[model samples]
Target chain A: MYRISDQQVDFILADIKKHGIRIESLQQNLLDHICIIIEQNLEQHDDFEKFYREIIKTFYKEELKEIEEEAIFLVKSKGPFLLLSRLQFFLLLFITFIGPYITYDLVWFFNEGHGSVLPVEVWSGTMVFATFPLLVLLVLYFTPEKLDPLIPRKSKILLGIRPFIKIIPPTEKYASYQQ
Target chain B: MIYSSELIKGTLKTIVLKLLTDNKKMYGYEITQKVKELTLDRIQITEGALYPTLHALEAEGLVTIKTEFIGKRVRKYYSLSRAGKTKAKEKLNELSNFMETMISLLDIKPKTI
Candidate 1:
């Protein structure tokens, strides 16, 4: 229920900035929170500067720095993964739909005069290649290289079968075997 | 009378979600103070720790934040999104069940089953 003038707010902002809160949203939240804490203190204490100093003293400055660093990190690191996932999603979606039909036609074109049952090599190759995109997607989804974009960045744990998570798809290796 | 830091760490998310479930909306500082008051200062959620949780919750689509301008500063008030509301209930129920199980284990009565 207490209020301060613009000048006092500026001083509070300066103090927060000086302490190294760089994220814009965090700075804003901290500004409001600090002011409210100050107002609460003002009801009991007379001096703004002294009360403000004392309240911040209760906080771990390292923790404050951690908050800022965490926010920035969550944004910078996760932003790319989220984008990459979306791109991967769309790319895979496109291939899943279109790839099989193309593979079937290509297999048929080379072996048009063959009987109803296709050759084992053609059938097997088509099966592997057709399911390639989906297999990659399942691997990516389950063995998440990063945390869900929604989870806090600091909570990044290499979840789910960590040893097998870093699978390099057998596309190139399989191609070598084909030769 | 503060609780161990480790104990508080695991439960913080559920605590935040549960608090939001009970209240219409709460700001960062308000959430901290409420937790302190409710627990009689035994559980103090520091500003440093609380903000990350809130941000993470926001990212998870569990909570939606509304920013209001009061004079020169911005006040961010967080409320549960629809999914958040459901998640809050589930998390609290899970925690309640876990607590009951822990209590039963400590009591150590041999089961007839």
Candidate 2:
């Protein structure tokens, strides 16, 4: 049987969480995985550090980032409807794109006999009306509206850019000291 | 040493899955050490390499983890799932065939250069 230090356990948990894996039950599961690895290595008389490094090297390969990104994409694709924020984005886009067209049609109907409104004039006016609301909606969307204290600031920025960058902040330091 | 790395790389997953199949449960370090001892240090797997594979296997649902407490520390143990066992058997069979082919090819001697 191999014994894992609480510190190491905390580190692994933090690393897993950092990658956006949310499984409360898996905490102990991960610990068990590490302990078994360590114990088996010790049985063979390998030094602790060498054994530890080998395990880490295999798991944290450069391709892991790509694999994670693909996983996230798979999840997002499978449950497209669950992404309310993305739905909101499309809603906003629809309103921005078609809102002015409707307004222009209404204006044309009301002012039909006064004079012909040139296509260029209608387009210019529609663009002017659409730009401001679109900008406002975009600003609102991009703003850090929600504050999650558990997330690190750097990680938050990275996450905001793309789901591909699943950087999880190290929370073990705090968790270990607390325990 | 000549063909050891290639052999290890080709058979790594089968070796790991087979060990898990037989041992019932293991942890990261234990797997590496077991491989080293079993091969007499001829095929050493670094922790950096092993942990990632373990994690990947867990991700793939091939293994499940169980935790135990030992004096204020927690040790993680991994065991193969049912699916993992099936996978192990298939992979081992494939590896066996590949190895046989390679051995036969290597045994062949060119006539008169």
Candidate 3:
């Protein structure tokens, strides 16, 4: 029942910021919660400064950091899991497979018996070797928290593969050579 | 009497979900205060525990959050999602059955020989 003045609320908010809660949503939630507690103390005519100080003492900076860390972690983990579980991830997988197959078919149709391009077996082997690992890496990236520990090292390996993969000739280059 | 961390940890989500099922929606501080008041100060949920639980529930698609500004500060209100409502029912039933089972196992009925 003890109502706090706006200036007092501002001071409380500044105190929370000083504790290093950088996330906006978390800062807001903590501010409101602290304000509620301060006002509750006011109903008993508790000294504002003393009561506020006592309340702040309960939350060490590390604890506030943990809240922010957990929230940020959950948000980061949720997006990829949610996306991958839905049809979008599968659609991307489908596109990853069909896209290359369609291009190969188109190239074969255009270059039948011309012998101007790499054999289909060779091209297929190259696609599987060069691209399938990249695709698996993409799938791992979107997977949930269970695989989080593997992501950092896996990403470094993928970065190493980038130049080698890019060295493969574009399908368009192969098609144009026949023309 | 204050509850142990183990007890609170196991039951917190069920308590929060049941509270939401009854109240429709509640903000962070309100949920804490409501729980404290209902338990007559026997149980007080610290903010550290509450916020993380709420965020986890939100992440799991069991709760939806809506934000609105109160003066200059933003307040987030939480309510159950469709899946959340179903989960709440299932969880509450499970907790209730567990409690009854515990009581039956622990209670000593006197035998009138």
Candidate 4:
């Protein structure tokens, strides 16, 4: 079994930080994980740097920074989040912008003077407020993947506390990694 | 046969939580190894997914961390917090229901081991 030296441990820790892990706790988590893999797999004389490069590459598709980003994302999104389909996201938007006016119109129509006829502003408000979301929905729904990369095809929108909104790919995307 | 990662993704949290319940405490790497061993190498939890989820669990107070210094590094051992114990049961029950629903919905027959 290979033993990791203090110098090598320091080197790995620094490298983890350099690669974009800013959170001290996360850095330590990754540091211990990397060291264990190295000591368990490598022979005493194996090139540590070369082996590290290969091992680290397996952790992410693009950049190592992604781990830190993902950690922050998960923590921030933990409180309250709604994962909605595209159609549902649009519906939520529609309700947020237009639901108030319809409620007001219904309340006014039932009160006394208005009778069954809805207020003129209700129709106007609906049209004015609805157009933007409608156009947004159309653009988001009709555009190609590249054009609407923020909300890709078959993706869900995560309405969360911190990032506010994020596009989540299908569950298959999360499960794509296997060792 | 190795199950697909997609099949594992939805249940990863539950699996991790369940493992914690079964064991007194565990670290990140030990959890991965235990999962592989218990599943007979059918399921592999990637570090990329595991660390973030662990951090989130810690942040949510679902897991309590105990750190120890070994050689030149800090190793954090995670055990279920009070909330985590409750959450583990809740998650397990939820996953059990989901699995049953899928079994019925897809008309999948369970293979006898």
Enumerate the candidates' DockQ scores in order. 0.23, 0.15, 0.18, 0.56
Q: Give the higher-lDDT candidate: 3 or 4.
A: 4
lDDT of 1 by residue, B81-112 (tens): 99999999899999899888977989966668
Tens-place lDDT per residue, model 2, B1-113, is 42354445546667889999989898766787798888777788754345545665676788888876665446678899988999999999998897779778899544672
lDDT tens digits by residue: candidate 2, A50-146:
6765664565435223334423333333211222233354464567675767677677857775565647777677677777777755554455345
Q: What value does DockQ give for candidate 4?
A: 0.56
Question: Comparing to the true complex, what docking class would candidate 3 get?
Answer: incorrect
**lDDT tens per residue, model 1, A1-179:** 56776787889888878887776767778888888877765864478888888777666553456666544333333321222233354465557664775668677866786556676887677667666766755554555445344222222221122221112221111111111
Best by TM-score: 4
TM-score against native, each model: 0.58, 0.43, 0.56, 0.73
Off by over 4 Å in 3: A1-7, A43-49, A59-62, A69-179, B104-113
Candidate 3: deviation at residue B7, Å? 0.6
Pick the winner on DockQ between candidates 1 and 2.
1
Give candidate 1 misplaced runs (Cα > 4 Å).
A43-45, A61-63, A70-179, B108-113
- Can you write out model 3's per-residue Cα lDDT over A49-116, one digit (the tens) per residue? 88888887775434456666545444443321221222344455466765666576567757776656
Query: How does candidate 3 score on lDDT?
Result: 0.68
Query: What DockQ does model 1 achieve?
Result: 0.23
Instruction: Report how far residue A164 has shifted in candidate 3, in Å.
Output: 27
Reference-based lDDT, each prediction: 0.69, 0.58, 0.68, 0.82
**Worst 10 contiguous positions by lDDT, candidate 4 chain A:** A170-179
